[model samples]
Target chain A: MSNPTAAMLVIGDEILSGRTRDANMYHLAGELTNNGIALSEVRVVSDDRSAIISATRTLSETYTYVFTSGGIGPTHDDITADCIAAAFGIPIDIRDDARAILTKHYADTGLELNAARLRMARIPEGAELIENPVSAAPGFILGNVFVMAGVPSVFQAMVAGVIHQLSGGRPLLSQTMRFMVGEGTIAEPLGALAADFPDLSIGSYPFQKDGVYGTNIVVRGSDGGLIDAAMIRLSNLLPEVTDDPE
Target chain B: MSNPTAAMLVIGDEILSGRTRDANMYHLAGELTNNGIALSEVRVVSDDRSAIISATRTLSETYTYVFTSGGIGPTHDDITADCIAAAFGIPIDIRDDARAILTKHYADTGLELNAARLRMARIPEGAELIENPVSAAPGFILGNVFVMAGVPSVFQAMVAGVIHQLSGGRPLLSQTMRFMVGEGTIAEPLGALAADFPDLSIGSYPFQKDGVYGTNIVVRGSDGGLIDAAMIRLSNLLPEVTDDPE
Candidate 1:
């Protein structure tokens, strides 16, 4: 069976404006890959309601799972929850369950639950909350869309709560063969090897270190035996250049 | 006049597979911002031809400028050039000028101009080559899309060749005010400040460093005087929390 496909939507102006480098996308990508879910695409849009709504709808319909990060904070600029509701044509209010979680968490810290703080309690109708262990604010899952916090710590915690529930396929396994030769020298043979194993994804990544050029050829597939066989063939193809023994 | 909007399309499977963290998007975002071009959106898609072609078309039509990085190498996975041509309904083949550049560069190193190496010479009709000083493989520009190499050094070199040609608007100026207060404590007042200055973008980013919680309130706008005025008001509003003294 084919692996479940996923797409990520990152909503923040700080990312687009170059004020902050996004950590959530990279973390989630690694997490999803480990979970045997193929994260096919990632879209980063600014904190705009229309853009968020449009991207959410498109990704939700196109992929098996759609994960969105950011814009779910207490600040005025946090409009992701409202946008998610608008995308699904649902009404959103301060759901009692979400409010209770936030209220208790804030009360324990001796912080007032002001209007801005209460904004975190707003959730779309017919949605399930994704618990945030690091922070009190809860992420929510509406349909296939999982809405999470923008902060790296909170996003990671929320993902941990929800990832185990999703169905996953065979985890993709990868083996790397490092060679001192330039990519140009190995492209032809690598191309041929790729054609021979159509199911495996063969990637050539070039690196320059200390005035020496090298390529790391990665062979990835679900089947360990096929990948091992392909690796042996690849090492044989470049006997002198490969670092691995025959 | 509004700043010219831009979008970035990162074409790579290594990114989706969690093998590589994307550095090009962050680099380009800062470059575009400094150049007065508003980078509004960024999409990271795999090396799939259909995905690349579809994303190219969508971004090209929506934004003033579209920058694409990766999948322009000589390996089997390098399909960006072909996909770009397909997106524009243009035929691509080995152009003599591009082939000559590669041939001369390789000849200096005593490397053979094999078929795989020659693949870099393929350029779409009516496209101009963007010089890669770091590597011989040239990136191309078709319409408003500036196709760049994936390697950081080569991509930066190629961008330097073409960035001066694009029309840029006012540079986005920003000022940051740091406070050792919780975001929830100031959200209501910050929201009022945001409503007062609709033209300026006010963003509150919370950070916890060495067990101390703080928020960096950033005011961004094209007008320096307005941002300065807003900063004064902000300092006045949060005298005790702000690092700045009254």
Candidate 2:
């Protein structure tokens, strides 16, 4: 079977405001890549309910799995759960299981579980809790949507908790050949080569330094042999191609 | 007057696919912040025309300025310029000004500007070209939307070229006070303080170490005096609060 398609929806105003540079996208992307699940799309929307609902609906319907990050905190802007529940046409309330977790954590820490902090316990109905080892507040999995945290460390922990349960397809293999040639010179042939290798995904990333121009041509595919074959042909087509040493 | 509100729309499938971790969002956010603009929202959509169009329309209408990155390349997936035109109900075609820039660059480099490359030259009618010094393929500004390249370096150059032209309000000045105290202890008082300072945006970011907990409380506002006053109160509230040393 082909790789399971996934997408991410990052919902936050902090991210867009330059107050926070998101690390979760990179972490999740790298994790998904290693797990053989193809992440096909990502939408970083704000805390607006309509925007979140619109994006979530579209992505959930289009991809096999949709992951969301942010807006699940204790603040008033933490409205992702409610938005997701609304998008799926389900009821959202304070779930017993989630509240228990939060209550226990707060009790152990000797802190008051105020209304604001209790906001973290509210989740969609009929959703399975994704445990947060770092913080007691749990994320949820409703149908294809996996609701994770906005904080980098918490998000990473939740991803680890859930990734093992997911079923993935063949891992995507990639080979990069960096050439000290300009993209303008390589575009035509590369396009042709990409067309020839319909199964392989060929990407040309251009970079220039001082006066020297180069392109890192990456060939990606599920089949290792097919990717290797494409790389061989690519090297033959562009003699300047050399393996990138990272 | 207060700082102008802004947002970003990152359009690319590659970014969502985990193939590319976007740098344009960070670059634009920082630039906007420095220019006294508050970036309120960000949406990273795929290459799908509908997704791009809807996101562009929504963000453009909501924010004072909307900057988009990616989907303006030579490849088949590159469709941002056309999408923007469609969103704004404007006609898009190969314009003379864009063609002139591409033609001049290709001519100077002695490279064949094929049909695919020429795709970069097509832009929406009435849009002004944003000069790209690194590559001659210009980004354009139509209404409030400033379309730019997906690549980090090129995106940086495009932002630099156009930042001076944008009308920005007073910059959002921030003062952060770091204290070796848990967020749970600070949340209530901070929330109360934030409510008092209606014009200021206050956020408490928590960090935990081995058996040690800390929070960095940031107070932001256009008025430096107001921010200072709030910070003074914050410092008094939490005696442990101290200035962050770079």
Candidate 3:
């Protein structure tokens, strides 16, 4: 059977404004890949309510799971929680459970649980809270969508809390063969070989290091034996002096 | 008036597979931001033809300009050229000018222009070629969409070539003020301030360094005077010991 597919939705104007380079998408991509959940697509939208709602709905419907980052803070622009609630047609408010979590954490830290801080207590109806070990604020899973913090550390922690709960397929296997030759020198044969084995994903990444052109051919598939066989064929096609099986 | 809005389409399986962290999106976002083009959205899709074509058409129609990266090489999975043609209903073939450029560059480097290398010459009808100074492979611009290389260096160079050609509005002006106070301590007042200035985008980025909590308040707008005025008000709201205007 095919792997369960997933998608990522990054919400924030900071990302679109180029003020913050996104770290969450890269982190989640690697996590999902290691877990064998195929991340098929990713979309980044601004802090607009309609944009967030539309993208969250589309991704949730298209994939088995959707993970969203950013806009869940206490600031004014942090509207992801509300937008997600609206998208799922559920009412959201400050839940006692969420409030209690924040209250106790703040009490331990000698901080006041003021009105602005209480914004973190707002949760969508009938959603499970994803734990945040680093900070007191919790991420929530509503339906198939997981809403997490935009901050890299908190987002990473939140993913760890729920990653083991999701059903995943076999971990994808990959093997790379590097060559000290230009991509054009091997493109034709490689393309023909790829056409022969349509099930495997064969990718060519070019690199120019120390003024020498080369390409790294990576063969990926669920079956390790199939990937191994494909790598052997690829190695035979390239020149003996240039190919370095890795 | 606001800046011209643009969207980015990243086409590749490597990014989605978690094999590669995308550098093009971050680089292009900064470039577009500096050029006064508002990057509204970014979509990352795999090497699938339908995904590429659909995203290309949608972004082209939705925004003032669309910038696509990846899938323009000579490999088997490099189907961006054909997809762009199909998206716009235009015929694609090896144009003489593009071929000549590649042929001359390869000849200078003592390389033969083989059939695989000639794939780099394919261009959609009526598209303008964007020169690649680092590599001979040319990027193209068809209608509102500018197709660029996936490689970071090459993409940056191509952007430099055409950035001056596009009409840009006033560059977005931003001023940042840092406070050594928690976000909760400032969220209420900050939210009220944001409500007053509907035209400007005010963002708060929180940080925790060396057991000291802080927030960076950034105000962005086309009008420098309005941003400055807002910053002055923000300075008065926060405590004097924590506020460090940057």
Candidate 4:
């Protein structure tokens, strides 16, 4: 089977404005990789409707699965649910299931469920809810699009709840060999070796410091045998190959 | 001056595959914010040509500036330059000026500048080069698009070199007030306040503990006086408002 492709959409103005440093993308990438799903793309757009809709349609069409973070809160700028509904050409209203969850939580806390707070319960039609362990409010899944919360803690919980339901392919396997030699001297040989092992993906990242040069050669592939074979060949070609802590 | 909107395109399969965690987006966002530029969107696409072209065109048309990170290296997957040229309906070739810079760098290191490595010198016509201090290979600017390297160090250097060239608007100012209360309780009042202060952008981010609820309310605007005025009203209403260390 071919690799399963996934994409992420981060919707927040705080991130773009540098007020908030994003943690969701990195966390999702690591989780998706471990689950054998290849995350193919990520788009971070503001709370604007057109931007979110345009990006969602394009990415969902290109990749097998699309996961969106942020803009699902009960604030004024939180407009992801409505935009997703618009993109899919579906009707949006307060789903009874979601309303029940929020209402129960409000009752437990002895608080009034006002219109502003109830906005969290407003989900699109024909969508299944993804449990939010951090808060009673939940995210929803519509077709291949998984809409989750903006806050990192809640987003993480929703991701855990939903990742098990996804269909995934073989997880990627990688090996790294770092050498103190200059990348210029190693480029041709490494490029030729990479050509020989067409199945394995090779990357040469160069580093310089205090008049010294170094390069980290990373070999990645889904097949373990191919990855190990390429690594052996690489070690023979460049005798200085050493283990990289990273 | 009106706020200049910008977007970022991060191109690399390594990041999507979870082999490499991205640092370029955060760095660029911070630099853009400090320079008074509003970064509205960021997209991370794989090495695929069609995906790159589509994202580039969409973002470039929507924002005042588009900064791309990654896919500008010497390897085979580095196809950002070609994709960008295609997006703009322009032809691409290895220009004399870029070739000159690359040739000089290879000459200084006494390394052979092969066809594959020379791919880095190929840029769109009528583009201005962005200087790379760490490595001699430079990035370039074509109209509103600034193409940069994916490596964290090189990408940062390029952003620093090019930030001064773009015109920026009045710097966005923000004031934060934290309350030790649940977002549900504050939702009604905050929503009304936000509606009243249509000129200011107010966001409430909630956090939960073992049994405690807390939230940070952020007020943003280009006008400092307006933000301050809103903050005063918010503090008076909440009565539990306190300074947020973040």
Candidate 5:
């Protein structure tokens, strides 16, 4: 991969139990792609200790950046921060910096900074806090692992805080060509187009809208010229094709 | 885990690239949970062959059943069947049964049964087909892995076809208790409730609606009575709490 590689580890039983849909992963994927980072893998494990720690260790070691969402809230089930600490064999507790932020925010909101809320201050040893403007509880970055909240709005905000700080390569460029034909009818030429432009990533997505079968041919690469070249070939291969997003 | 453990290996570049969100994982998670199977882990990898093969082998070894979505189409990007075959050391080719299904469907639809379309008929040596009512190109069952389509309708149809054949434990039971207070305000007593009901999985999720902060406490277990008992304690602990889904 030309760009930096990343993996998202989504931690929560709510998702595993099918109670909640995955929003953070989708948001992070778009942000990473826009920042020229290739999201290579994603894993969703329930709020279990061993599973969390094992996934953290593997993803942290494998990818350039590992972003985790969920399990950092102020509840007993919120064990992501502790799992990160355990994954790296680091001691974790309510850090002074995080505790201060929570204390100040809770005081302003008129909510008591009790032990439950105080649990949010538990940060891994020697980690930098990622600012949470939405909620006062901060996400911490331990090594390459960026631990954030599960809530979609909060996760998106934390990403905004973290994304600009990291180094990025050239943003990936993509173009789509729509053909009013099924994937089976267009597969052979699409495969040929993919082979011709070995550098670009070409994907065929089929859709059925209003009883009409169509396929979207998406070509992605950092080089605009190569993507254009691939799309031109696709258009020539199918005369009726349109370079449409719809 | 009292219920059978299952893992979902999502094979596609579309999800990782942020061009498409993960609808299949969410659908499968809910379906698996309702069928008395505990969806333990989910891994989403790109269209790369090695990544697909590695994930397939790992999840197959770890979980009781492995369900993979995407990459079963006729396009060049569709390499899931080949990857699954490679992972299990099986030779893959267009089987007569799958070909017959496709042949009949194409004859009915008046679409050509060309070589590109025939790629969908490639099945592993010993695999049984998972019928696709939405589309004729069938998904297949190879050992513990159930390879299905990426399209939501087709994947759901394939899942419905396969879910009933598997032996399942009792479906997981769950009850929700809502407190008109923040998670921080209710975390301690909720932790105590969780401790008392060791067999139950208790979770606290915070939400903000119309600027009002509240928390939803979800209690889940195989036994309905245990879930009810835990919910009662939660009500006793917080008298303002109501069993609400919203």
Candidate 6:
């Protein structure tokens, strides 16, 4: 069976404005790949209500799983929870279970459960809360969409909390072979090899190091034997396989 | 006038497979921000034909400008040019200008301008070529979409060549203030402050450094005076303005 497909929706003005380089997308990409889920698409949109709601609905419907990060904060600008609720036409309120967790955690830290802090306790109707170990604020799963915080540490913790529940297919395996030449030199043979394999994905990444252009051929597939066989054919096709491209 | 809103479509399976972390998105974000073009949305899709075509159409219609990177190469996986043409129902084939550039570039480098390399010469009808100083493979501009190379150096050069042509509004300026408190501590006043300055965007980024939770308030706007005023109001709201959150 094919791996479950997923899409990531990264919501933040900081990212769009270039104030912050997003760490969450890269993190989730790696995590999802290892879990055997194919992360097919990623979208980064600013903190706009209509944009968020539309993107969430589209991604949730298209992919098997949809993971969203950011905008679930205490400040006024944090509107991810509300957008998620609006996307599914669900009623949301300060949930008792979520509030109880935040209350105990803040109390332990000697911080007040102020009105602003309590804003995080809001959950959509019929949604299940995902635990956040780093912060008391909980992420949630409404339908197939996984709503997590944008903060790197908190998003990571939430992913760990929920990853095991996701059913995965065969983990995609990759093998990289580097040649001390540009992709143009081996494109024909590489293309032919890709066609022959049919099942494996063959991609080339070019780089310039010390003023020399080289290409790294990455062969990826679920089957180890097929990947190994393709790599052997690739080696025979190339006149020379460089020990290191760097 | 509002800045020309833009979207980015990053095409690559390597990114989705977690083999490569995307660098182009961050680079373009900073460049567009400095150029006074508002990059509102970004989508990273794989090297699938339908996905690329559909994304191109949607982004082109929605935003003032759409920038696409990757999948424009000599190798088999390079399908962006064909996909872009198909998206607009335009014909694409080997154009003289692109082929001539490649011929000279390869002749100087002592590499054969073989059939695989010649694939780089394809250009959609009615598109203007974007010069790639790093490589001979020319990117193009078709209507609102600026199709560029995926390689960082090449992508940067293409952006620099095209950025001046795009009509931009006021450059969005930003100022940051650090408070030795969590966002929850100052959310009420911060929210009120954000409401006060409707022109400026006030955002809080919380951090835990040395076991102390602190928040960084970032004020962004097109008007420098308004951003400055918001910063002043923000200082008055918080009790302590820490020199550093680290």
Better of 1 and 4 by TM-score: 1
- Using DockQ as the measure, the top candidate is 5
Stretches of candidate 2 above 4 Å error?
Answer: A1-3, A47-54, A75-77, A82-96, A103-118, A239-246, B1-3, B75-77, B86-94, B103-119, B209-211, B223-226, B239-246
lDDT of 2 by residue, B1-246 (tens): 767888788887566657677888877888888889988767777667898998889888888999999878776557799999999999999999999999988888776787877888998999999998878888999999999988788899999999988899988788898877656566667778888998887766666666567776777778999999999998888665533210
Kindly list the per-residue Cα lDDT of model 1 for residues A1-246, writing each as its tens digit.
789999999999999988899898889988988888999999999999899999999999999999999999889999999999999999999999999998898888777888998999999999999998876889999999999999898898999899999998898788998888778888999999999999999998887776677788998878899999999999898756743110
Worst 10 residues of 3 chain A by lDDT: A237-246
Query: C-alpha displacement of A185 in model 5, angstroms?
Result: 1.0
Candidate 5 ranges with C-alpha deviation above 4 Å: A240-246, B240-246
Ranking by DockQ: 5, 6, 3, 1, 4, 2
Q: Docking category for candidate 1?
A: medium
- Displacement of the residue A48 alpha carbon in candidate 5, Å: 0.6
Off by over 4 Å in 6: A241-246, B240-246
lDDT of 6 by residue, B1-246 (tens): 688899999999988888888889999999999988899999999989999999999999999999999999999999999999999999999999999999999888777899998999999998999999988799999989999999888999999999999898888788898788888888889999999998878888888876788888999879998888888778788575544312
> Each prediction's TM-score against the native?
0.97, 0.85, 0.97, 0.90, 0.97, 0.97
> Could you tell me how far off, in angstroms, the CA of residue B163 lies in candidate 4 after the best superposition?
0.9
| DockQ of candidate 2 (2 decimals) | 0.32
Q: What is the C-alpha lDDT of each candidate?
A: 0.90, 0.81, 0.89, 0.83, 0.90, 0.90
The superposed Cα distance between candidate 5 and the true structure at residue B45, in angstroms, equals 0.2
Question: Could you tell me how far off, in angstroms, the CA of residue A198 lies in candidate 6 after the best superposition?
Answer: 2.0
Better of 5 and 6 by DockQ: 5
Q: What's the distance in Å from true for residue B81, model 4?
A: 2.8
lDDT string for model 4 (B1-246, tens) is: 478999999888777766677888888888887777888888888778998999899888989999999878776567789999999988899989989988988888677787767888898988888888877777888878999998788898898898888898887788898788777667778888989899888988777666667887999878889998999889887665533211
lDDT of 2 at A21: 83
True contacts kept of 4: 0.50
